[model samples]
Target: MSGSRGIVGEKWSQKILWICAIGSAISLYLVGVERQTQNRFQKMADDLDDIDYSEKSGGDGT
Candidate 1:
């Protein structure tokens, strides 16, 4: 476009673009991996509020 103009340096522009592309790809991969952890937590449902203190060390101070 005539309105958008930049003095392109082969070294800086190419390196920056490559880094941005890799960062976006890694972020997407991490998001996909995190979905499994979210599912595991969701399976707990209402039991999340039930803390089992009786199993603690010294059996909850007897």
Candidate 2:
């Protein structure tokens, strides 16, 4: 019946919407994680730069 077909179509639409939402969430999470990782590494590099490496490397011969 036409009504039954409409019900089936509605279910499929809901499933597709759920899939898209989940995919978007995962994408956003991955992007955020990547940005955090980059920031962490940048902070570490800044911390290293703040140290006096010249005094410690004097005996290393360059």
- For candidate 1, the per-residue lDDT at 45 reads 53
- Candidate 2's displacement at residue 6, Å, is 0.9
Question: What C-alpha lDDT do the candidate models reach, one value each?
Answer: 0.70, 0.87
Instruction: Tell me the tens digit of each residue's lDDT in model 1 across 1-62.
Output: 54344444656698999999999999999998899788878777534434344454335433
* Cα deviation of 27, candidate 1, in Å: 0.6
The TM-scores of all predictions, comma-separated, are: 0.52, 0.75
Show the colliding residue pairs in model 1. Answer: none
**Tens-digit lDDT string for candidate 2 (1-62):** 99999999999999999999999999999999999999999999976765547556664423
What TM-score does model 1 achieve against the real structure?
0.52
**Backbone clash count, each prediction separately:** 0, 0
Every model's Cα RMSD, please? Answer: 8.5, 4.7
**Model 2 worst lDDT window (10 residues):** 53-62
CA deviation > 4 Å runs, candidate 1: 1-8, 44-62
